[model samples]
Target: MFNMILRVTENPVRRTTARDIAIIAVFAAITAALGLLPAIYLPVSPVPITAQTFGVILAGAVVGGRRAGASQLLFLALVALGLPLLAGGRGGIGVFVSPTVGFLIAFPTVAGLIGWATERVGAPYRLLPGLVVNTAFGIGVMYLFGWVGMMATTHLAPWAAIVALAPFLIGDALKVVIATLTAKGVHASYPGLLRSRTARAVAGAA
Candidate 1:
């Protein structure tokens, strides 16, 4: 029974389909577009508040884990290739080494984590569970990585660095709520867009 439970819960590895690639590419572009939104810079921290994280949340919630991560990775790859795809029109190799680098590094990772959690919440994406997963992964996990990145790059004390990031919490919280609602709508309309691996398997068997 225990083994059966594990099997039922497991996310089976599957090959990416062409449709997955198209969705990934579209989300990557959406991420870039969100970067074009005006960034609000705070005096306390070097990182600016932008709508990009909103894109990150949407990518993970709308698409499944692997594809969402791939989309974020693809967006970062474009940024690295000298496109000005970041907030305030910043990009290229230098941006990767900049103070915001840690947050940038967290992009793909957080998206993947968010997708994984969203999948665990299963289909129909309930409001509470969806919000909880998005908050935990999108804000909590993302901030952790960004905090570490800032300390390593700027040589700031840990407490001071995290303190500096306090201003971003409010905006990010709003993003979480908005993204969760948006995802819920998408899941309702599409129904099959964000299904868990187990859910997909069950559907196939049916």
Candidate 2:
């Protein structure tokens, strides 16, 4: 049962290795560092454009589903513990009640979803599918949760959240593309960064 929980896909013994743990920690730090970038706030929107999501997207692509989720959860746990790792240096328990709370809560889910998508789509392919997959799950599901959070916290109508999110569409698309390309490149160059299903099976056999 524990193995089932830890399996990246079908193989259970993939690695509770130091290497896997290191990748998770490094990616968590990467997300925090990216969050330190100055956010670009549009006059009309409450959420700002920040680089943290770039790390969020890449974490899944590079680390696979389980490790990616761990990295994101670790980042969130630190923020909740007053690490000041969020965008604009805000942190602690108060963050869960903010207007942007939905996005904050959904961060781990986003990384997991992206990693799951990457695992299924299979890498080293033509990237258009990855772009589509990332955009669908990453941008689409992300905002859906964010929109729900906005309405819940801000007491706004559904249309208000939908309307406000309009400014972010283009930039997020670009992010999806960048994340897909970068992840694929990393996979091609260093296949061991994450073991594909085939790769894992082969390793297990030998």
Top TM-score model: 1
Q: Over the full model, what C-alpha lDDT does candidate 2 score relative to the true structure?
A: 0.80
Please give the clash total of every predicted structure, in order. Answer: 0, 0
- lDDT of candidate 1 vs native? 0.85
> Residue 63's C-alpha lDDT in candidate 2?
78
Which ranges of candidate 2 are over 4 A from the true structure? 1-15, 40-47, 196-206
Instruction: Tell me the tens digit of each residue's lDDT in model 1 across 34-58.
Output: 9898887767556567899888888
**Angstrom error at residue 182, model 2:** 2.0
The TM-scores of all predictions, comma-separated, are: 0.82, 0.79
Q: RMSD, each candidate, Å?
A: 10.0, 7.3
Residue 139 local lDDT, model 1: 93
**Which 10 consecutive positions of candidate 2 have the poorest summed lDDT?**
6-15
